[model samples]
Target chain A: MSELSTAAAVFISIGVAFDLIGGLGLIRLPDIYNRLQAATKCVTLGTCFILIGVLIQFGFTSIGVKAILCLAFILMTSPTAAHAISKGSHDFGIKLWEGSVVDKLAEDKSKE
Target chain B: MMKKMLFHFLMLFGVWLLFTWTLEIPDVIAGVIVSLILAVLLNSIFDGEVTSLLNPVKLFWAIIYIPVFFYHMMVANLDVAYRVLNPGLPIKPGIVKVKTKLKSDLGKTTLANSITLTPGTLTVDIKGEYLYIHWINVLSDNVEEATKEIVDKFEKYIVRFYG
Candidate 1:
């Protein structure tokens, strides 16, 4: 195999590993918020790496440019989606893990 | 107002061009229609030159910020990996309120998203000038201290970009 495809293969494998780790985190984490932390961070980074691998393989061709666009869209949107989920879940009364330390939002609500 | 609208139209057109990557007459026509609609809708939302993002200086800062953000992301990913894999399951999860001085909506949104994107921290809510952050490790409970740790890294560039 050529060096470029080899590099791409390496990146793709690492990305897949990260995605798997994120899935594991969901099962191991004790609460919804913690699970979100895993799914959002790991999976988004993993997907980006995969897209970057695609970019490396395709260069600046049409497909590569499309991959760049996909990367940008995922990078921008996923974190915001996670934020909304975290906030919405908290507001909807999803409980934090037993070991968690604080709840500033609930505290603020109580003050008001 | 018309000139500003035109400016946004051109900017969106450039993005549309990039996304489509074709000079065929049909696609170009569709790109024009879509970009026109998008630019107008976005203009209505921002009510100005898209929150100083279109400014050359701020654009330069945004360019600089992308690499810095990616670096933080890498560190955050590694941090998450270690926490997830660690036998002890080391996470001190909590929500802490941190203050931000930015007044612009765009700036605050960018800051909130930046906090969320960074590993070990997710922005839970923003009320007034304060952001409630869900941190994996609660190193500080003091508002000023937490703000310093969380907001200081990205706020400068965001402020410059949105000013």
Candidate 2:
């Protein structure tokens, strides 16, 4: 394989490892907020790295350009979706983990 | 109005070219026709002067912002990965409210997204000048310090264009 392909392979491997860790985090985390933190950040970065690898492997061809576009789409949308889910769960009265150290939102709401 | 229409047409045509990745005469003709029609229909939805998108200063900051954002994202991934893999999950998660200096919707949204993707913080909601964030590790209960840590980094760059 070419040097470029070797580089791509390295990136793809890193991405896959992060993705596996993200899944493990989802199962191990204590509550909805914690799980969202693990799942969103790790998986989003993992997928971005995978897309970067694809772009590198494909060069500037259509496939490479599409990979870049997918990366942009994911970067913009993934966090927004996670933010929406967290807000929704909070509004639905889902409690934070018992070990949580603070609840400023609750305090703010109670103050009004 | 005409400028906005032209701007939208060009933007849509650029996407069409990216999607098709072809330069055949027939493909060009179809793209032009489709984008022109859509541009006219969608131009009203776009607020502000479309010319602002072409500003050199704003464009320059945007270029600079991408790398900084990506670097933070990489750091965040590694931090979370380490926390997830550790035998004892050492997390002190909490939802805390932090204030932002950004006034524009665009700036605030970008700041929130940046915080969510950065180390140990996920934006829960935005209320006016304040953002309620779910921090994986609550380093400081003080709103000013948390804002200094989380919002200031991205806001410095984001304010240049989006603010």
Candidate 3:
């Protein structure tokens, strides 16, 4: 196999591994916030690596640049977006896990 | 005025280069012309000259702020990952309204986004000057301190950047 194809295979495999880790995080994590954390960070990073691989294999300059831009966009936006959705869910009043150790927000509100 | 337009065009040209794989003269020239037209059209629609490029100081600070944010995001992700996989439901979730002194709309929005990005918290609503956040752990069972942490770390930076 050519060096280029080998590089492509490596990147694709790394991306797939990240995606799997993210999926595992979603299933294994306990709450909404935790789940989103995994989904946004792991998935976004994983996809970026995968796309970067594709960009390398295909020497289309425009595609590579666009993919890099996409990676940047995801890095910046995904966590914030997930945060927004989770916050919205929380504001609507979701229950926390019973094993929770702190409720600082709740305590401070009472004093005020 | 012309230089500002030229820079905007250049940025677009860079974008165009990413779209087309060639670095030939014809492609470069075409990219420049198309980008300039786009800039002109955008300027007209916005009813003013776009001048984000005019502020060198703000631009410089943005470069500094981005890396700090990335580090914080990574740490938050790890924290959340541990909690989610912790077997027991260890989250103490609740919604609390945080009264913030940040006056600008950008400040409020930044505060909201920052809170949301952290591992255990979410920004639910911004009603007037109040920020409602839903936190997963709540740290100390103290709402005010919890809210303060959100405002201090994320909102403060955003206010400085966009406000």
Candidate 4:
């Protein structure tokens, strides 16, 4: 196998691993907020790294640029989208796990 | 006028580099013209929060911050994975309001975004210096520790950048 092909395989494998890790996070985390964190950051960063690898394999063509553009868009938008969704869920009053240390928001609001 | 034009031109130049990956004269000219048009349109529509592109020092820091964020993402991912796979619902979920020291709107936004980005926590709302976060699990019911973990890692750097 060529060096480039091997590297590409490695890149794709890493990307797939990130995606799997994200899925696993959703399953393992105690609640929704935590799950979103895994899905947004670990998965997104992993995909970005994998895409970069693919771009390197493509050797700086328009296709490579497109891959980079996709990566950039993901970086900018994913967290924002996740934030919106999580906030929406919170507004709906999704319960947090049983062990909670603080309720500062409620406390501060009452003080005001 | 010249300074404004140069600023717009540099932006266009960056776009051109991203799009075409070429430095040929035609590409540079095309980039300059397109950027000028964009600048004019932006100048007409833009209001509030103007930032300069020539600040290489700030850009250098931004470049540094991304990798740091990546590392945090990896850690969050691992933490979440362990929680999900554990047989016991050993989860402690709650919403806590933590005080934020970040001042700028952009800085706050970035901080909120990062908190939501990390696994096991979400930013529910932002009011003044306080962030309402819904945590999936409370490792030890230590809201202060959790707040420190996030604010120290994410918020501080975001303040350094956009604030």
Candidate 5:
């Protein structure tokens, strides 16, 4: 019945949709690296959208500002963690998909 | 070094203000004091200067960068959705090294973060000027070509801010 509610609903739904697709990506993708790609993109962006919805729902209030802070925090933390995860996995010797065509990391490592 | 610390102080104070929206004198005093202490404490953790992202032009472009980044995020999400929905699940994931022309460490971090934010590509590692990226869809094997796909749009805007 209200504009704020409707907007929040829309945002939450889209966010959940993204989250679901990300889960699907985790199962469908072939390897750990690909699974990470899905998890990072889906969860970060999905959660951000949900936070944006909360922002719209509670504009300029204490909670709204908290929502903004949460968004910023997620933006800062998630990708750094992903970078670390992917690097650690690669360094730990997880093999890429058989179809994978190029690996500049191994090439450089061998050259070194 | 002093300027970067000041910048950090201002940022922390701004966040404090956001968290504590009321204008009481005690809160203001405490926020400023806390911000100063943390700024000095944290700023010294780094050996040298900060990026000093204070330029007006850079600020303007940063604001503009928001929409473009969101658009890329949406496109990437939809792309992933499509891949997931498809029965074939077409994906050609790989690690391709791409070179970035940015000179600063912050610039490099920004570029890598941007790549990771966009779906289908995750930056795995950085060695010197090269980035090892996990690409969900490897469109090309050539380094320059892959760099064009992964780094071009972001590097163009990020160069103005950090590099």
Candidate 6:
């Protein structure tokens, strides 16, 4: 009921909402690339917000410091993992959705 | 070489202190030993002037960049959420190549990561000076325009430290 806890609760709620939207996007998006775009951006920020909320609730305690460290690790690693997955799938010849506007990578490869 | 080793040692020891969160004599001694060993083994990985890590101007810019990055990331999350909730699902996805003036590995990697987290773009791969990004909305097919839109915002900040 205190102001601090209320602030934490609000951030936590927003994080959960983003996470749910990311999950919905994974199912609703038409292709792997589109899915990666939605899932990586939303889920990363979602988890980061949750960690921020935890940090706020715990202050500078060991648990709070660990939350910040975990947030940094996720921020650095999540997009790298997504990049690797997208690159791997593209190399394996997975086709883009027909709605895609351009395929610059494919064009470059063909030209080579 | 000595400076690089010392820099690495300090960084490693700082992490060790954070993990243990106790300043007992025994813990400090153990941290120093472990950090020294790792620093000796891994110092070669750092190619930049190790002293640059301590530069005040660069550190200031790096601190400023954190909030800028977080703001863009929050906006990008909301954008993705909107597209997900929209009934029409207004997205025109594609792989586009964008150029970067940043030649250093650290700068390029950081730029690519920033691009992945911002707006509707996800970095697929980096080839030479060009980064291939999967864009959810195809606003422009030209290399200059795409680069301007995706890389320019972060590039200016990143160059201050990494350039």
Tell me, by TM-score, which candidate is best.
Answer: 6
True contacts kept of each: 0.64, 0.84, 0.42, 0.67, 0.81, 0.83
- Model 1 residue A20 CA deviation (Å) reads 0.9
Off by over 4 Å in 2: A1-4, B48-51
Worst 10 residues of 3 chain B by lDDT: B44-53
lDDT of 2: 0.90
Q: How close to the true structure is residue A23 of candidate 3, measured as C-alpha lDDT?
A: 88
Query: How far in Å is the alpha carbon of A73 misplaced in model 3?
Result: 2.1
TM-score for all models, in order of appearance: 0.93, 0.95, 0.68, 0.77, 0.94, 0.95
Ranking by lDDT: 2, 6, 1, 5, 4, 3
Better of 2 and 6 by TM-score: 6
Tens digit per residue, CA lDDT, model 5, B1-163 = 7778888898889999998988899999999999999998888676433445587888888788889998998888778778777999788878888989998888898789889989689999998998999898888878899889889999999888776
User: lDDT tens digits, residues A4-110, model 3?
Assistant: 68788898897777677778888876667556656766676678779889788876566677787787777668757876676566556665555556443445445
Which candidate number maximizes DockQ?
A: 2
**Taking the tens digit of each residue's C-alpha lDDT, what string does model 2 give over B1-163?**
7877888889889988988899999999999999999988877787644356578999899899999998998999899999999989999999888898888777788888999998989999899999999999999989999888888889899988887
Q: How would the docking of model 4 be graded?
A: medium
User: Per-prediction TM-score of chain B?
Assistant: 0.89, 0.92, 0.72, 0.74, 0.93, 0.94
- TM-score, candidate number 4: 0.77
**Cand. 6 TM to true fold:** 0.95
Q: Write the per-residue lDDT of candidate 1 for residues B1-163, one digit (tens) a residue.
A: 8877887888788878888899999999999999899878877665663636667888899899989998998999889988998889999999899999899877788788888878699988889988999989899988999998988989887777874
Model 6, which residues run further than 4 Å from truth?
Answer: A1-4, B48-51
Residues A1-112 of candidate 2: C-alpha lDDT, one tens digit per residue: 5466988999998999989999999999999999999999999999988998998898999999889888988999999999999999989999999999999998998899
lDDT of 4 by residue, A6-41 (tens): 777788887888788777776776566666766776
Query: TM-score for chain A of every candidate model?
Result: 0.94, 0.95, 0.81, 0.83, 0.93, 0.95
Winner on lDDT (3 vs 4): 4
Tens digits of per-residue lDDT for model 6, B1-163: 7777787788889988888878899999999999998988776777745356488999899889999998998888888899999999999999899998997888888888999999999999899999998999999989999989899999999999888
The docking category that best describes candidate 1 is: medium
Off by over 4 Å in 3: A1-18, A28-34, A48-64, A76-112, B1-10, B43-53, B99-111, B140-143
User: Taking the tens digit of each residue's C-alpha lDDT, what string does model 5 give over A1-112?
Assistant: 3466988889988988888888888888888988888888987889999999988898889989999999999998999999999899888998898988788788878898
Docking class of predicted structure 2: high
Question: In terms of TM-score, which candidate is stronger, 1 or 3?
Answer: 1
